[model samples]
Target chain A: MEYRGAPQATLVDLLDRVLERGLVLDADIVICLAGVPLIGLRLRAALAGMETMTKYGLMQDWDREVRAGAQSLQKGAALLAGQAVQPGLH
Target chain B: MMEDRSQGQVQEQARPEGAGGEAGLYVYCIGPALGGGCCGVTGIEGREVDAVVHRGLSALVHPCPVQPYQTANLEVTASWVQAHHRVVEAAWKQWGTVLPLSFNTIIRPEGGLSAADALRMWLEHEEGALQAKLDALRGKAEYSFQVFWDPVVIGRQVAEASPDVKRLEEEVQSKPRGLAYMYRQRLEKLLREGMEARAAQECRELYGRVARCAERVHVSRPKEGQEGQVMLLNLSCLVSTGMVAALEAEADGLSGREGFSVRFVGPFPPYSFC
Candidate 1:
């Protein structure tokens, strides 16, 4: 995963900006590879459009829910995934 | 003509990437002049790269197929992306600041215009704006900073401070099973909200501190990866090349504080700025 210097910019970071942040010249020049829009990759598995979600005041609520789920539901998920049991969970 | 190009696709029996037959220009970035000699960088798919000068500005491009680089197969895609970045990095290393175009930005003959001609025409039209950006970005590079906090660590810290949560935890342990379940739920809810609020507040403060050192600061979406961590701030900053170390030092200082893991990357051509 190493490139010449600087820990080979994380694929997620590079991909996120590669298509999403740059200047778009027009529609005609934009081509899709394998029927998938280059920028269509989601940022993370569960959280989608985090910036947009945050902008509309939705991320805080979602964050709260996700954090709470991490605290409680992670135990069940961990069990299912066969991860080491974390302490202090009933 | 467009129909002809689309229909002329040659199918590769085993390759999944389809046909990339027609030669087109893959535009990497644009800069002022770039002086004499080629950048000596290879473009996507190992194609030899050179610059096309137009009215004092030069574009680093290579003859790539017009087809988009496939994303379905990540291994192939990653190599292409790495190659793309390598070329831009080469250009930046040799010729200071560059306005980087996005990956897979190919220009093919459309509306009877040749690929190079179309590229030249676009450069001509955007010459003034492009030059302005190049001048502004000269001697500057983009750096990325990401701050993440371990949820367990932050939650434990928050709980230690919140008396209400302490009382709830005690109740959860002592009360009847059904009632304790409710209390535990309530406790988890409060802690989650508090930690989220604290992260947001910390993000604002961190961005302010980092912004002072940068000419342009772009706040990006926080990326959540690990199960027990939350991204506090993700920023791409444009700063003078000389100030990058100072910025990293600042990040190092920030990382020394508890519950914060900082990822700082760059000296990259100002991709976000362009």
Candidate 2:
């Protein structure tokens, strides 16, 4: 509510990520959501619907999110690499 | 890069290189107010590069050809980075409020106007962040106090806290699996809590010492990855920058205990406030 602290988006999001549901894999999850408005709904449902949360289950979810982030990062990397070849895009 | 060929450096050369574009411009950062045109940096950099001064603010930028951005290695990229850094560094030193954008933001041909609309949203957000930090430390200069535990201190302290050492030799002689597991968990928690308590105690002590000398203090965690417990207690003192050394000396007096240490870095860009 008060804007006196650190920038809301960076700090609030980071703290929320740390204390609550924990960190999100940026690359995997957000890339798909970049053009889609559904990232929140999909991610929220997946997390809320988690059937069991044994340590292993927790790790599995972590892995899935990280894998998605990795995929997103790969896409960005490829785009950057493609930009390297395109004289016009430079 | 062609100059007026001072003393005929360009003219005297047997093979003159291609004329460099005096046409180039450097872009400092893009924020909302840049709709009109840049109000170039005036005296510091020797060039007349200006900001796109609009809405009572501006983005100091330079125009550049789009071709070089495609390079894979960081060649043309380096020049832009250096130029931007120069502006930012000067602005920080000169005491102007600026929101630094990450490197290499460019306007597509004729897209500067559209860029301003988006820029407005972003600049407003970052500007709010800047103003918050500014207000937080309005008259203050930052001070940092760090305390690192001497290995001897950590060992002695943890050794004193652990009740299991007696059990280590006497009751747990056989290393019972169940008890050992419980013992390790408790030990870890105790050790962590002990270290944290000491760190907290030091922060309070440091805060007390400097509260007299400073208008306000804002603490921050030491950056991660360093080995030492890097317990840093940051403070922003509203006194003139002239008081920095005295504050450091005062901090040094308080931090002089065996396991504690103190250092100060600033008159900086007011990053903590921002």
Say which candidate scores most in DockQ.
1
lDDT of 1 by residue, B1-274 (tens): 3332223223211224334455577777777775865577677778788788888888888866676554333334445666777877777777777777777777877678777778788889888988888789888988888776666677788899899988888878889989988898899788866765566567667777888789998876554424554556668899987777777777888777776677787766777887
Query: Residue B128 of model 2: what lDDT?
Result: 59
* TM-score (0 to 1) for chain B of model 2: 0.51
> Cα miss at B63, model 1 (Å)?
2.1
Model 1: CA > 4 A from native: A1-8, A27-90, B1-23
Once fitted onto the true fold, the runs of candidate 2 whose alpha carbons sit more than 4 angstroms away are: A1-90, B1-48, B54-59, B64-83, B95-147, B158-189, B204-221, B225-243
Q: Can you give the lDDT of residue B205 in candidate 2?
A: 62
| Model 2 per-residue lDDT tens digits across residues B142-216 | 333333334335545655766764344345446688997777666555555555555555556656777666655
True contacts kept of each: 0.13, 0.00
- How much lDDT does each candidate structure score? 0.65, 0.39
